[model samples]
Target: MTQSGEVTTLKGESTDQIFNLKREASIYYSDSLSTFNDIKSAFIKSAGNSSLQMVFLLKGKLNGYLTGSKKACLTFAEQQHNILLINEKLQLQIKTETHEAIFIRIDPAFLSMYIPADHLGYLNLKDGMQKNEPALFSGCNLHMTSEIAAILNALRTSEHTGFCGKLFLESKILELLVLQLSQFELRKDDPAVRQLKEEELDKMHEVKEFLMNNMNQQFSLRSLAHMVGTNEFNLKRDFKLAFGTTVFGYLTDYKMTLAKRMLIEKDVTIAEVSEKTGYKYATHFSSAFKKYFGYLPNKIKSGKLSLLILIEDFSVVFENFVTMIP
Candidate 1:
């Protein structure tokens, strides 16, 4: 491993390496990472500039805690992704396993260039760490679709090195940023999705915690609302307003997330997965899984399809981007 200033470099095999930080007119980033050993935790002070970061966790586990937080604010298990807007220093605690991850940092101005100027005014792309407000466009520990994972793998394992490799990697990074921006553009503005009153939000959160804890069980809206000391109408509306989706939508997504993790990380059977995810019928589970991920659970279990396929497949939907590529 090598170290200089705030950067601590580690060496691995051909597939396991770290590229030095690259900078241009509007972007700055360290090369991709695939580490084979665990190292001590360290601190990374932000550059003060408002830079949005897209982080891909290809393999292993990474735990990141804020300076004064009691617990980790960011945890990247294998095959997860995160988009971070950094405005303060951070402490990283590496787990005792090999880790593979990549980070791409974008200057806000650079990002603005791609976004329509009028739409850009309404976008929340600022660092909210100092003001104690939520950072605009901040999404931490997000799920990694199969397609994105493939792109990350291509970037990580590509034989291209030096200038050509750098150029290729930069192009891939731009592609990813475009994908993310397109996603944001498609999101319906929740004019009605404003923040709920503190008490209502707290109650809604309680309902969410209860649902997560009892994921293997089923409940109606009325029952869930009663459990959390709210009515069904308010529960349904406020939960969606606070969490950006319906109650069951979030639950199903959460269940499938766990199902994917269990299927990949363990040797559990399909029926076992169905039972664990609260489906009495394995067929029901399979159908829901296919609907949510656009692939079968059997494919995921058989190693025929992976989470990366989602990004790969979705990118083809953008005809302009597809035409731009050779």
Candidate 2:
């Protein structure tokens, strides 16, 4: 078994020698973030175990199932969280084109330092899975809030190294802990809300993928619900539970983020970018862009020195995650 904080590679056979593939897994540990990068061309399973782990999927999609069990395939989407209570029955078949995530491994004793006296019981229950015979794994699909996204993006893109960079990274990790705990508190009381079944979650993911792929096309909740074989109410409820944003809210943020990328990276005109991102009118697109990004699209195109300087300045402090999947 490969040790933690090291790389593991496996080569598999194929009909054409050129088509054979090698998969690599590496873990990087620090005081705050433990980043895991897995690049694979075929299926793979865990050879080593871990302590109680909180995994945040930052990029790519992965589907897997436990070995020697009848449970269905589990889908892990980008911007989601998975809580795994590690144990022997935790063998998994994780397969993806490429997978990258951040895993925070914690022991209950150490974690208690971060919890308040009032919340100790809650943390205890969550940590209780470690004592169970079979490992327990729970997952929640959360919308990447703009705050968390900004910090993550900065962390991913920063060029800084040494003690200063490490300090910045650790602060962001603590911010995520606060945000995640707050979000958890918001939902933990809603026992009336049903937890989505595996198939239901899969269908919701399909709905999300569809919306993302068709960003230029307009979609109504009713139409989307029908496309995903669900009713509108359940669709809205589950999407919010899984993604932490209303359907239209998520779509708008997505469109605006895409628009920013095009404005910065592509040589396309404002009208062209607008049409490409689903706005029929440039004025409407400009207004939405301003609202979302605090600057008009023309400011980006006309090379307004002040706004451009502002963006560059912010990039130093808060560059958004450039690797976000469109």
lDDT by residue (38-89, candidate 2, tens digit) is: 3121112232334455556655654445557667445556657654454454
Off by over 4 Å in 2: 1-53, 58-79, 83-101, 104-117, 120-122, 125-158, 162-164, 261-273, 293-326
* lDDT, candidate 1, at 19: 44
TM-score of each: 0.53, 0.57
Model 2: how far residue 281 lies from native, Å = 3.3
Q: Check candidate 2 and list the clashing pairs.
A: 141-242, 143-243, 153-321
Write the residue-wise lDDT of candidate 1 on 86-137 in tens digits. Answer: 4444445555534555665554555554555445322544425335332435
The global C-alpha lDDT for each of the candidates, from Candidate 1 onward, is: 0.56, 0.54
**Model 1 residue 244 CA deviation in Å:** 0.8
Report the C-alpha displacement of residue 301, candidate 2, in angstroms.
7.3
